[model samples]
Target: MSPLPTDAPILPLSQTVSAQRPGDAPALVAALERCRAEDGAFAYSAGREIGTFRIEARTLNELAQRLAGVTAVAAVALETGPIAIQPCWTPGRLAEAEHRLGSADGGTGDFAVVRLRIVPRRSGEGNIFETEFAGPPEIDALNAAVARGVARASAEGVEGEGRIIDTRVVFIDGAFHPKRSTPAGFEEAAIAAMRAACRTAGLRRLEPLMEIEIMAERDHVLPVVNDLATRGGSELRRRLAQKGVAIAAELPLRAFLTYEGDLAALTQARAKIIGEPQLARWAEVRRR
Candidate 1:
């Protein structure tokens, strides 16, 4: 799936869907219907299909903080409990918590660091908290806990690894202690709760595929169609006329951008093209 602008806000589904030109995107509608058949939900906003990476606690804290570094990622949300905190958090108590968690360093004692940030609701109705946790580099104690929690989140219906769907995090509760509260201990609790809640929320991965309708001269049609395939484009349907051919195809979002301009040049500006986003399957990103 394509990433959204990292600093941009995610609008609610209702509003986003409402803004779309309903009947104009039959391919998108069909794709979404297929996703529904697979028990998936639409998670589009600002003309892009949104996907989230499930970050386990074993990864470096630097990696956690660098999630936003991906240029395509519109924003990173810490799915803590019922709260979905965005990167553009307000300067308040939640921000304070996030800053504190981010500044915490590991290596001195039996400590773990969990970065937290306060976020507003997608509807702009309210606020909730989200956080990420990390433990010692050499510890295996928290691995099972993190896995279990991620599994729980997946069960709750998040578009784990890959899929065409909505994304979110859920939390229930966690335990901590002043004397013996190890970072590993808190991390286990956090991961589990977050994952379970994600399932409950029904987050699914949705790949961003472009549904393009193009009309080109009869002679140029063969060359045009061949070009599309090389860029991961798949022809879904085609229509022929006296002088031109009208075809619909699905292509990866990134490939579509470059091909759009190329199509114009290939057709000598004779091709008519219209594109809309459609959902495809989810793809899990296997981390090393």
Candidate 2:
């Protein structure tokens, strides 16, 4: 996920899917489908896919506030109990709450940090949000940064080790010394650490992914087929399969800016972007 744009309004982004009660996504998905057939006016990317993340929080408001920073968090909603928070918040206050976001499932093994990334949603300002939680420096910095951002508007949060931490990186042990320059271990470590730092910094992952539908004239089918055959740099999860050939792909909001329009152009302007990508066993289930 990219950093929040300096000029654009922050859109809601997230990586917290489990935040919703079990089965909530499926129920919501079914409901949206019904609405589409009956109303035919569902906003594209409305039904967002949810990614599960852990955050340590005593109340929902604390979670919501920090989430507002990562650039991904949308309007915070309560999953199990009523969510209570102030209508408005500041960057400084959110920083202190950095450590508050822990996985509802796992609390980073006593480590105060977690790995995370911000994902943009389909609607609103398209700001980025947090995803996942790891440990150590990333978690530490994120926790500190969030408070700092919030402090820019509210209270002074705990200051983290301002300098970049090296432990933040991870190495995918290539079995036994093989090839390449350590496989970007430093970069990977930094990302994991950065994400953790974001979570700690108060950026909550809201599990926001985009759902795109492509429709093109019959004559344009050939190009569409060709693109589908060769489009490989990214991961595309096709959510719906229209036997008639109108293709639908559940694209991760994490990387849409790169080719969002390009994909549509290929469809001959006949594309119809649907709701947000919802989390599932398989992001998209398509038949050939």
Candidate 3:
């Protein structure tokens, strides 16, 4: 067969603000509190235990600069908005840059600035790619290409081979012209702009995340969960659903060694499973 095209569009995102190893917990908390006091929209997402909070910041840099001044900054956590990230799929040059960015010490030197380049997975194209690097910390002086690289490669996360397919980044660029561009046009143009840049950067698609939700009886939850763990899962979240005593776990979509029918028989039809694309960001699919 003939080779497919590798010219999919790429987008870059720069994290708004970041806080390096703040000194102590109380100080960091204070900085976060200060951020909350400001007025604006802030989006945050962390692990179930980590907990995410968003208040407001007129500008990301303003917030980061303030947070940086905090005493107990351990590792600067960059706001995931339009920041540069690095992963394996990144180009050798970008990879090297990431290394330099991460080499510095947080205390004496700049924060380890890593960049993850994310490439989209076009049909017959190839796998999505992401590259990581380390460097000094900053508010939002990140390059555009690097941010898109991270988003594309992270299209499906690191779990599913090609299941999860959405990693959108909200960027505030250009003006909303009535004849030139509308509000929606501005949004799409932002995505397209990044996508075009991705093509120029020469990055490709990487693995996506998956959600293999399993519905089973209460008694079978343990066994089902165990079986899922036996397989490779980059990140998994488990929760018991309403009725059916359903035990649903967001697992990698690539896991296909076990059969649902057999599992059903083993659990006497009390167990059922289903999987589908967890589309949150398709690099440039949805409207931001």
Candidate 4:
């Protein structure tokens, strides 16, 4: 694949007011806050948590590098709309620039940032940010390409990969070849950048968990609840239904390894289990 130019800038998003046009500040901030707050649950899968943020700096490679140094961050992407900020920032450079430019003179350009944590899973506990971006048609296409690539790579998330497939990466900035820059090229770049960030930030294993509801005959309630307990599942709510007991629980995906068969054996295939995507949490890091 062709290499991204050395000078390709990855800018940090800023939440600043626009002097003329409605700076992407308000809508961007609203979107980011909403996403972060509501990022509590998802129906799909992808790598890592996704967030959007407003851009303040012109370039983010330095900032990303600094974040990678945090030892807990796994990866970071500052993007929304068609533009994306490649993983490249260094904290030292940003600090130096800030010191040199001073607060008032230091310009926080207009853009959005997306931060991804690699080590510790937030488990729907902490705040996840969000942002929005507007760019040319090419930018939109580039963002789509990045999404498609990441999704394809993460397709096995629910199939027992033990990873989330909901990695949200969008374009914040890049160099386009016009003739040479196809979605494939840009997609490779996006994935490469994220992987690079992960390497720098470190990776941790996290398992996708499911929020499940099970309905069974009255006679089977005790047995089913026992089964859940054995598999590390938690019974959240239980009520008597018209014909049986209704059970709500939280279960790790791994427990499903024999769940289908076990449920059949325990309830004689008469029990119903409803599964929905739930927040992911950190698990023991698997050693190679």
Of the candidates shown, which would achieve the greatest TM-score relative to the real structure?
A: 4
Candidate 1 lDDT over residue span 24-57, tens digit each = 3443434434433553222322222332222211
Model 3 lDDT tens row, 1-288: 111112332221113333333334344455555543562333222222233222222233544554354323434354323322211132111211112221222323222223223333333243333222223342122323334433433342333122223222223222222223222322233334444334455544432223456677778877776666664332245565675554445433233324466567668878876554241222211111
What Cα-based lDDT does every candidate model obtain? 0.39, 0.32, 0.36, 0.42
Question: Against the true structure, what is each candidate's TM-score?
Answer: 0.33, 0.23, 0.28, 0.35
For all predictions, the C-alpha RMSD in Å is 18.2, 19.2, 18.8, 20.2
User: What lDDT tens digits, residue by residue, belong to model 4 across residues 56-127?
Assistant: 233234333322222122122223233221121111110100001112233342221222222222343321
True lDDT of residue 179, candidate 2: 24
lDDT of 1 at 27: 39
Q: Per-residue CA lDDT of candidate 2, range 127-198, in tens?
A: 333324334443434433432332222111112211111111111121111122132332233334344444
- Stretches of candidate 1 off by over 4 Å are 1-207, 275-288
Off by over 4 Å in 2: 1-211, 228-244, 252-255, 279-288
Q: Which ten residues in a row have the lowest lDDT in candidate 2?
A: 161-170
Worst 10 residues of 4 by lDDT: 91-100
Error of 4 at 210 (Å): 6.0
TM-score of candidate 2 to 2 decimals: 0.23
Give the residue spans of candidate 3 off by over 4 A.
Answer: 1-206, 234-243, 256-259, 274-288
